[model samples]
Target: MAWVTWRQHRPQLVAAAGLLFALAAAALGTRIPIEAAFHRESLAACLPPAARTGCDIIVPHFEAEFGGLVTSVRVLTVLPVLAGLFVGAPLLARELELGTYRFAWTQGVTRRRWLLSKTALLAAATVIAGAAASAIVMWWRAPYDILEGRISPSSFDIEGLVVPAYALFALVLGVLAGLVFRRTVAAMTATLLAFGATRFLVTEFVRPHFLAPLHRVVLATDSGRGPGDWVLSDTLVDGGGRQITAAREDLAVTHAQLAGIDPHTYIVTLGWKRLIAYQPAGRFWDFQLLEAGLFVGLAALIVLVTVWLVRRTAT
Candidate 1:
């Protein structure tokens, strides 16, 4: 079963390996200079809960130089979908579509066992490949991540257990779609649509609420940043928690200047404060584990459904 599976899927396996190699090469080549420059600049001094005055002058320049890489990394968000379309969607669909599953199933193995073996093999391969890709990306992005914080979608999605889990989810989604659609192209399309929608909804809506976000209030003129927090929103509010506008803030500052009082002091007297909502940096790993578990659980459920459907078809 394993040999037959490998023979049938060699193209996809080879392609996945090639893609991982290319990503590693690109990441390593780019990361060497980035790491060197980061050390050379001694920008660790600018990390939060510490002096950041130098960051005002230095960080922008670093971003300007390497910002393209940052944008490029965002493109990897689509990688799992590609895996589903090419690898998983066609895994069973092609055989069933070609009417070759009949012959394939008669080769001395029960259909259910055959299906489970092939799916499990492919899933294990995908997890390994996805982990390799995640490791490469995270290692390459370490310098940028340290400066920018990893809680953002781009950083969080591509690192730790989450990336492999995402790949697993997409793969199972593709397999399920393939079984239901029974045509490779149709399955691919369904996989793309379903995976895209699930990912979009989770990323944009569900992930943020995994834990209640934290809040901090600062004086209107004072700097407010804790180390590596995923800042959700900042609002200017009075003691009553009514949102205030920038225009109102500027006017208040002007009035304070004319009255010979410090702007911050004046704002405090008026009960104006900046309210920041954030997910603390300490929660990075916790969120990673939670999101990964969510996807993995979904994948397991899909696997169970696919198995049930396959067994029914054979019966």
Candidate 2:
């Protein structure tokens, strides 16, 4: 069964491997200069405000040099969709489209076993590919992540266990789409749409509410949120819990200017505070596990549905 699975999916396996290798090579090539700049400029020391006298110049210069590469890397968030479209969508759709399912089903192997074997083999390949690609990206972006925060959508999505989990989910979703559509092109199209929609919904709606965010009240002059913190909301509020209007704020600022006092200091003196709801940087792994488990569970459920559908068709 393993040999048969390998023979059937060798092209996909080879293509995935090649893609990983290419990405790894790109990451390795770029990482050298990025790390050198980081150390040469002593960017780590500049993280604190006291040490950041001229980091404004140094940081922007470093960013200008590698900003394009970081942008390109962020675009790799769609890699799972590509994997689904090319590998998973065609897995069963091609067989069914060519009417080879009938021939394959008639062999001594049971339909359930056959489906499981193929799914397991391909799913493992997808996971490994995802992990390899993620490792390369993470390594390449280590300096950027250290300077900035990984809590940002672009960095978070491409690192840790979530990457592999997302790939597994995409692969399973494509396989399920193939089972339903029975046409390679249609299945691939459906997989792309479904995977994209799921990702959008989760990233926008579900992820923010995974854990109740921490709320902190600080003086208006101070933004207590750090670089890696995922700030949900930052609102200017009075002691009475009412949001301060911009017009009122402007009036206050003008009054403070006339009084020869800083507007920010005057606002705080008037009991205006910044109420921030955020996920702290320390919870990175917790969120990663939460998100990865959600996707992996969904993939398992989709695999069960695909298996059931395949069995019913065989009967």
CA lDDT of each candidate?
A: 0.87, 0.87
Worst 10 residues of 2 by lDDT: 47-56
* Reference-based lDDT, residue 143, model 1: 92
Model 2 has how many clashing residue pairs? 0
- Candidate 1 lDDT over 68-138, as tens digits, reads 87888888888777778998899789888999988988788988898889889989998999899989988
Global fold similarity of model 2 (TM-score): 0.89
| Model 1 stretches astray by more than 4 angstroms | 48-53, 220-227, 244-270
Model 2 agreement with the true structure over 168-233: per-residue lDDT tens digits: 999989989998999999999999999989989998899888889888898888867766788888
Runs of candidate 2 with Cα error greater than 4 angstroms are 47-61, 221-224, 245-270
Can you give the TM-score per candidate against the true fold?
Answer: 0.88, 0.89
RMSD of each: 3.5, 3.0
| Model 2 Cα shift for residue 287 (angstroms) | 0.8
